[model samples]
Target: MAAVRFADGDWAEDAEFAAYGAATPALRALDAETAHDVAVAALALGLGPRRRRRDGEALRVEALGTTFSNPIGLAAGFDKDARAFEALLRVGFGFVEIGSVTPKPQPGNPKPRAFRLREHGAVINRYGFNSQGHESARTRLARRRDAVAAEGDDATAEPRGVLGVNLGKNKLTPEDNAADDYVLGVENIGEFGDYIVVNISSPNTPGLRNLQGRKHLSGLLRKVLDARDKNPGTAKTPVLVKIAPDLTDAALRDIASVVKSEKVDGVIVSNTTIARPDAIKAHAHGDEAGGLSGKPLMEPSTKVLHDLYKLTGGKITLVGCGGIASGEDAYAKIRAGASLVQLYTAFAFEGPPLIPRIKRELEECLARDGFKSVQDAIGAAHRK
Candidate 1:
């Protein structure tokens, strides 16, 4: 097979496109709806640079009972249907979490639902968990896994990386029956995922974040754990809860206690934020109605990671998201107690090249900080 060739300056080009592409009048002739279709087409064609591989800087860490080749992961919402898994893995993610998939396919919110805030290097998306749904994802993943297994190579020969599935409640599913939706999602796709993330924090879903409350969280986790326990396998799959960054410290502590008592595998420190920082206040899309994610979210999400680390006393695993654009940002999350880190908006702005850039930067940061490995850097910032 011929090797894929990613365009030169693709990362910078993506940034430029987000900044000025729409202003070209001819391009602006295409509305947001058409623009998205074009972007998806470009991604499907693999339009970015080949990831830079660093053998000496490779990172190994164990979390949720699975070992990851590196600490960086492609956060959910990037490939909502698992469409880009092979390409994404090649781009240097140690793990890839696909979807906030609903039990059934849905068109999601109306057009113009995704807004780019170029000034802040952020995106505001109210996609309402739009997806091709669990069955499609499950079918694709099973095929991929089987193909990998049939290659008959050692673990290293296979992708040998983690795949996480993020599940969400369908729009029509009432909050009262949310657990049923989540359970169905797990039953369908859990077998394919190395781990599963229960995503109840997307601002696009009405009354979703309310599930973060102790009563609902405990009840939901209990059922999901029970399902995992009953699966016909020797190993138990880890279940993680993804939380919003807007939670107060008191709320975070309450959730941490529940996570501990319920034996939840980990917590993704944030989804996205409703709070807009002053730095990006002048941007054109500043008033967009959706969760904001990008550079502005770095400090806030890292703080949340640190607080959760302190609250859980390092017992619960944490996956940090929000504003992680480069290796320094990723290393900061590691030191703040993130066992793994993820990004979405950064990818949207920087393209596939950002993946290797971050890994390279992280290795340099770890060495500069006198840490022998990525794991050694975990919680270093909070310790200070």
Candidate 2:
């Protein structure tokens, strides 16, 4: 068992966080996916860490018409079925995004699709949107809402964060008619989330990234936005799009154009990269067929975010993702124009302590740069 020492600002002070640290070695003994399953199960049982300290004003962010206590969020794919979002939110994520959920349940690709590149601090996953589908997630969301309602004061009873529902199509859905899947997602679980993400970027899903093309993207967003508008319950919910990191300059520009033209709420700067860096290629699973995420992606993904930020003229909210394992990385994303940031690969590797570490380090960065808050630092690089 790992000794849980109480350092002044370490996450170990939290019993739940310390429990995660103590379990790390054992969890690491299991296969990557199995460990993920166990972690999710544990979180669902309300075993995840809870915040004992309030976020400093420097970490607060106002975006997508809502106020986030902090600017860091857990990206989608961590809780794909929404089984543990409440617990996850309690774990100190400014927000928790669950699902890459399909309209119907899917077993996803064959097993052994998730790989850890420990030496490189990365993961390659081809989960292929394995999901329990819309209904399952909606049921959980409904239950959470009901619980909050039962408490009578949602402001105090609910967790302090946002919930983003990431929507994806079933594998069998054809490319041309993909909008139907996203529209259904909005009509079904849209009202349950603070925001919705149209996840057209997961490389594991066949031809899904093709939707990023300008021609297809405009039509898709139009339909999805229409559904959002028509849904009485979710009419005011913000909708963001998740895009891949592997895009040419022209493609990036085209996506920026589409996003602005369609009036999309925001864009998650990237999902994951399909490229295998030479440094990681020698790893057994480095050449695996899937989206690559973690440290290796920081440079290219941030470059994409910078480009997109310039392309959009900083008009739309951008959620920076991919390769964020430290405060400096998150700060870079923020300076490049991300109003908010998220992570999964790093969290998978470091477990619960990472959340506070990053946030604390981020606050340090903000202070070092002489910025008062995350908002002041956003797009700061562009000013230079």
Candidate 3:
């Protein structure tokens, strides 16, 4: 773990890159899952070293009725339990998503389910919605909400950073009953989150992806939205659906239609894919039976994001995920049509230093293109 320094500062050029080479490999020496736990613990204790890059006005993005300090957010799987979101925010992410929490606690798939494709800068995991469940997460989230409210504006003024909960049903839940678990999550955790994500895309859970089908999707979203509207004094939280990159174009179009008709707030353009690209074939874990994330997923995922943008005519906000490793990758997503982009594998591989590096490069990319802000860069390629 990096030492905690009270003085806020950015990394020295030589020091940051040296830390990157040492960081991921050191974590990889331990088993994949154990390394993940250690990282999460470091964040919860506020010992995680972050390179704080002050966002230029060009980096701030307004979406979903809130201002994002930057368009880059930490993706869901990184902090699945919501225990360390405040610490993560302090790490300089515009937002940090936690959970995929189910209605009931689950142990998830058997151990050794997470693998590192080091040569390929990717990971394959069949974590199967491993969640601490809704109750535990709700309490944690509610506490953060109450504490932040108590702090009242005296809290750091960084665009009131966003906290999103990505909800998934328990592994034991049958397909037909999945909606029940999702609704249960929204009812229990919605009021505490800036937004809620209906995660029907993870390929690990049996029949979970089936829920993405139009029939299942519409019903599930309607019930979840109804739960939100019925929350007595709670503000209406935006709900988004996460999809897999493996879907066919027809399937993608169907999803876009459901999102539009259901009045969903946004789409998280992809989840990790189950497909193994040929480039990673030589890596021993290349054929691992799990959803894959990292460098190889960049193009396919961005293509889907771009397609979804055109399919929706840029009507819905899109949070692009999968294979984002640098500012250029992030910039590509924005130009492809992502209003916001997410980081997980990049955060894991490059460490916290990557956050500021991305923020700086992204703003530079926007300026180079003659755009005023990240928002102006959204869908730039499509507009061209």
Candidate 4:
């Protein structure tokens, strides 16, 4: 089979596209969950794509106390258990956030819970925070850290971009006790992440979204932040919240108020939507019970990001995620107020070639708008 070729030009590593192209057919033949597992396993073995080009200066972003060579990050849910993070970073993501990890291991929902909406460039997943637990993930990260320390370069080596640890509650955990799970995440695995995400918006988890309620969210953030403060290794780690896209205007306002009042470091807008659009409802398994992400998510999620940006007056850092399939889509998120952006479904569908293409297109968009850097473009739409 011929390798997939980029329309614009051949800038990405040829071997990367060749490997993905050869593997795509076989991967697609398997169930979505199994395919993802196979891909992650391949990546974990260091067989993933290698980015042959460096990010241009136009895409650089300085946020969360470090410099992201580019603003595109691999969102959580892709590497739920922390496996393959290093390989993913090497694939050209400016950062990689792994997990929605729980204090204990979970089997997640039953089989066949992940579906690909190919016609819509989307995915529906009810993975329900399937994780091998904090201990498993902690051990993986610890080994990597130890390896670096052994090299005597731990103190001086530039970070391999930013790594974020996303935390979630176990399905069996009651709503009232959810805070304990998150605090446990910080205490156990927080030191490994450059930032921490308290995920309260996954639709698959029963009653998990309820934590987004102002009353509950406020208490949760405070305890999580306190855990960060008390943990010597994580004292300065930035803590963020990931919310759902289906929130009401009032709910967004409440969340904004709570976030500002508590001085949370950032907000990822959003997780996935339970609301099915007409386009999605027409697809096979469109009615499947789970959170919806991908193309249909682009607009609404950015709208929520825009609303939250306005509500918070842009004080809190915001990560734009949902349906970013191209550089134009990513730029839209930045203008809507995301300091950085992430993508998962699109990457899964198109593979590694999409990464360089996005950065290339984003550079064109920035140049077209006369913006010198990603920071200058962020919230530019709001100003106008």
Candidate 4 matches the true fold with a TM-score of: 0.95
Arrange candidates by TM-score, highest first: which order? 2, 4, 3, 1
Candidate 3 at 162: error in angstroms? 0.8
Task: Note each model's CA RMSD in angstroms.
Answer: 4.3, 2.9, 2.2, 3.5
* Overall lDDT per candidate, in order of appearance: 0.80, 0.91, 0.85, 0.90
Model 3 TM-score on a 0 to 1 scale: 0.94
**Model 4: residues with Cα > 4 Å off, grouped in runs:** 1-12, 152-159
Query: What does the lDDT come to for candidate 4?
Result: 0.90
TM-scores, each model vs. reference:
0.89, 0.95, 0.94, 0.95
Candidate 1 error regions (>4 Å)? 1-58, 155-159, 233-235
Error of 4 at 151 (Å): 3.3
Residue pairs in candidate 1 whose N, alpha carbon or C atoms collide under 3 angstroms: 294-323
Let me know the TM-score candidate 1 reaches against the reference structure. 0.89
Worst 10 residues of 2 by lDDT: 1-10
Candidate 1 local lDDT, 221-297, one digit each (tens): 89888887777641378899999999987889889999999999999988999888876667788888888888888
Question: How many steric overlaps does candidate 4 have?
Answer: 0
Candidate 2 segments whose C-alpha is farther than 4 A from its true place: 1-16, 154-159
Per-residue lDDT over 1-384 for candidate 2, one digit per residue giving the tens place of the 0 to 100 score? 122334444344566576776777688899999999999988887776666677889999999999999999999999999998887787789999999999999999999999999999999999999999998888899999998777675555434689999999999999999999999999999999999999999999899999999879999999999999999988999999999999999999999999999999999978989999898888989899999999998999899999999999999999999899999999999999999999999999988888888999999999998999999999999997
**How many pairs of residues collide in model 3?**
0
lDDT (10s digit) by residue, model 3, range 1-384: 455454544445336434644665788679889988998887787666544556788988888878898889999888899978887786678998898888889999999899988778899999998888888998888788788778888546555578888999988788998889988887888777788899999999999899988879899988988887888533468888899999998999999999999999999978999887788777888887889999989999999999999999999999999899989999999999999999798788777778877888898888888999999989999875
